[model samples]
Every structure is written in structure tokens, then in C-alpha cells.
Target: MTTVTLPEKTPAHTGRTPGRPGRRGVQPLALNIVALAAGLGGWALLSLLGFEDLPGPAQVAARGGEMIADGTLLDDVAASLRRVFSGFALGTLLAIPVGFLMGWYGVARGLIEPYVQFFRTIPPLAVIPLAIVLLGIGETPKIFVIFLAAFLSSVVATYQGVIDVDKTLINAARVLGASDLTVFVKVVIPASAPFILVGMRIGLGSAWGTLVAAELIAAQEGLGFRMQQAQLYYDLSTIFVGLITIGLLGLAMDRLLLLAERRLTGWQERR
Candidate 1:
């Protein structure tokens, strides 16, 4: 019997995969380019339409250059970032352990939750006046504001994440001869990492906002202080610059946290 002979291998495709490198890269770049173009075009149109007071990209760029020349802008940014980092670090360190203890032990939960819940309702901004009265209008008040902002947001998330850990996995660990502390360290922490990272991101954002609010009353250097000065002088361009810088910095921080989360909890994400 004669049989038809077929080729050993199938043909190599010429087309790219749906989300492969070529197609994916082009799509996002094209979209971003279009958006940038549209935004600049709108600014130009607004200027032409007699919005003289509203600063456009070029005006903001020029203002940024002027601020860099003066050297105040960098100093302001450094001050704000330092305050935020210190407060956020301290708050998260305190909150995470307390939150874990509360979530893990019934007695701890009963003892601490009432205070946590009560304080969570109080606005961070509302406490600034009280902080100033007690701590005075110094670095203490600003740091306290950021601490409150980070603690309140982080504790809730940490508490929830610990409680939400899978009971079955914990039991499995116990059956496999793991002690409570061992299981907690190995299984519970890994299980809850994503949630913890998510909480940290939220707390970081809150700290940034609180830094601005805290600086409002204070004497000295920060992006918020710069913005307040600009407002007093009615330098709209400078105000815009301060705001834009805050947004960009916040965005960068969030992206950094996202990268950390992806790196640390990569296994969970894969599943």
C-alpha cells in the first residue's frame, strides 16, 4: 500500500502572538503618545482661548527651571520626604506587630481593638491642631501626623490579613509537625504577604497626604510649604509645579511598592 508522505514539522508562523513583545509594546506606546499629544493640544487651545492665568506645560517647565535655579524646591522636597519616611517607618513597625498579635490571640484582640476602631474614625487632619497644642509647631507635630496616618491604615489591613489566613493550610502545617510559631512563620506569613504589602502601599499614600496637611500649619521647608507660599503670592505656576511634583513622587513610591509585592509574593500571583 502506498501512503502519502507528510512533512516532519509544521510550518513556522510569521505573525506575532496577541500580547507578545512587538504587539504589546507598540499598543501602549502608541496610546501614551496619543494621550500626550491630546493633552498638549488642549493646553495650547486653552491658551489661545484667553486662559492667561492657567499655566501650560511649557510655563510649568519654565517655573520648575526657576525653582531649581533658586535651590528652594529641592530642599523642600527633601524635608517632606524625610518626614514621611521616618514617620511611615516607625508607624508601620509598631502597627504590624500589634496587628498580628491582635489577630492571633483572642485576649489581645479584646484588649486592643476598641481603641484601634475608635481612633480609626478620627480624621488625621482633625488631630493636627491638638498635636500642635501638645507637641508644638515643630517636627514632632509633622511626624506625629504622618505616624497616625500610616498606623491607622496599616493596622486595619494587617489585622484583616492575619485573620484571613487559610485555616486548612495552618492545620496541615500542624499535622506535619510544625509548631504554632513555625506554622505562623512559614505558612501564615507567606499566605498573608500580599495583603500586608497592599496595606503598606495604602499607608505610604496616607503618609504622603498627611505630610502635606501637617506642613500646612508649620514654619518651614516642604512641598506643601512651597505651595502655601505660592498661594500667598498667587504664583499659580509654582502651585502647579508643587502639585505635579507630589503626584509624580507618589506615583513613583506606589510603583516601587508594586514591584516589591510582585517580587516577594510572586508565587501567589502565579497561582
Candidate 2:
């Protein structure tokens, strides 16, 4: 027993497993940090290399902090968010029924499809001047433009989703004596929901993009207005701040929609 026996050997790679949940979660966070650091480093280098007009990260941070302290940034953010939400809500609400009707009924499709195609071909930005003339250079025009952007983007997706539903499933439901309304409510709607949500995400992006052009018409207090004013003064830092804020806000909203999609579509099999 006292013969100098070595202890039992353990696996050398006995640390965290490669596919562990903790590692999976930490990887994205680590990568995000690294990416942010690299971007800031590159920005700083460029500014030091005599891009005199370009604002460094530090300069942008300082300007943003100043705006935050004076409550200007918050006001702009709130105003922009309000318009986006209101317009997005209006558009999505109206689009879902219109889309369902177009997809579900032949008469609805025949009447509406041509108009939808015509309007959708016209960019929301292109409609801004008309909107201003018709609705006035006020909140109504801006909201209307945003509404069109969201509505057009969503309606097509919703329509296609319904059209793409599994034909077999509908036949099965019919064989089971399901009524038209029952089949639509139980089969079509559930099948098309994912597409509808995807459309909403696209619509949200369109809404944000069109908001800038809409605000350009005559906004007094949104992020787009803030950036335009900064540009007039040649204030690069504020311009960067506004651009970054919009990017980050849009990213956050997109992620939320993705989260919703995952939750709603959990019934689908993973690869």
C-alpha cells in the first residue's frame, strides 16, 4: 500500500463542455464586447490621423452626454419613438385584416391587389411631398408616410403567408367537416402567423427609415430633426450621436421581434 502509487488520472480537458448553455450565452457577449472595442479603436485611429471633421468616439460620447444632461436627447428619442409606435400600430392593425381578406377571398384579391401593387411600387419617401400637400406638413403627413411604409411592407408578406399554407392540412380539415370559417381560423391563421410577424419586423424597419425623410419635411423635435440641425451647424458629433441612436434603437426593436417570433413559432422543428 505504501508503494508510491500514483493517483488516478483525470481527463485533461475536464473544463467546460463545448456545447454547454453557459458557454453558448457568454460567447455572444464576449464577441459583442470585442467588436465594440475594435470599432472604437479604429475610429480613434482615424480621427488621430487628421480626419479633422470626423468626431472621435470620445467626442461623440461627450456630446451625447451633454445632450442627455440637458434633456434634449431624451425628448428627441421620445418624440421619434411615439411617432413610430403610433404609425406602426395603425399600419399593422389595418394591414392584417386587409391582407387576410385579400388572401382568403377572390373578390378581395381582385379588387385590392392592383392598388396594393401600384402603391407599393412607389417608395414611401416619394409619397412624402404628396402626403404633405394632402395632409399638410404636420404630424399627420409624417405619420401617414410611416403608415404607408409599414402597411405596404407587411401586407404582401401576410398575403403570401396565407397563400403558402399547407394545402394538405386544409384538405384534411375539410374532410373532417370543418366549415370555411373554422378552417381559416384554425389552420390558415396559425400557419400564417409567422409570416405576419416577419412582415411586422420588416414594416418596423421601413417605418424607422421613412421616419427620417418624413421628419425632414418639417420636424421640430425628433432624432431626424436633431441630426439635420447638427448637419447645418457642421456638428459632426451630434450627427454621429443621432445616427448611432437610431441604429441602436432599430437593432433593439428587431431583436424584440425576433424574440417574439421564436416564442410564437416554437412548434416548428429545429434543424
Best-matching candidate per lDDT: 2
Worst 10 residues of 1 by lDDT: 10-19
lDDT of 1 by residue, 1-271 (tens): 9999976542345355444454435487689889989988998788667696688778888999989899988998899889988889988899899889988899999999999999999989999989999999889999998999999888888889899999999999999999999998998778878878898999999999887788976658999988988888899889988998998888888999999999998888462
Q: For model 2, which pairs clash?
A: none
lDDT of 2 at 106: 90
Q: What is the lDDT of residue 156 in candidate 2?
A: 95
Q: Which stretches of candidate 2 lie over 4 Å from their true place?
A: 1-26
**True-structure Cα RMSD, model 1:** 4.1
- Per-residue lDDT of candidate 2, residues 1-271 (tens digit): 5788777644435555445543435588799999999999999999988787688889899999999999999999999998998889899999999999999999999999999999998999999878878998879998988999999989999999999999999999999999999999999999998999999999999999988888987899999999999889999999999999999999999999999999988987764
Residue 75 lDDT (model 2): 99
Q: Which candidate is the best by TM-score?
A: 2
Looking at model 2, which ten-residue stretch has the lowest summed lDDT?
A: 17-26
RMSD (Å) per prediction = 4.1, 6.5
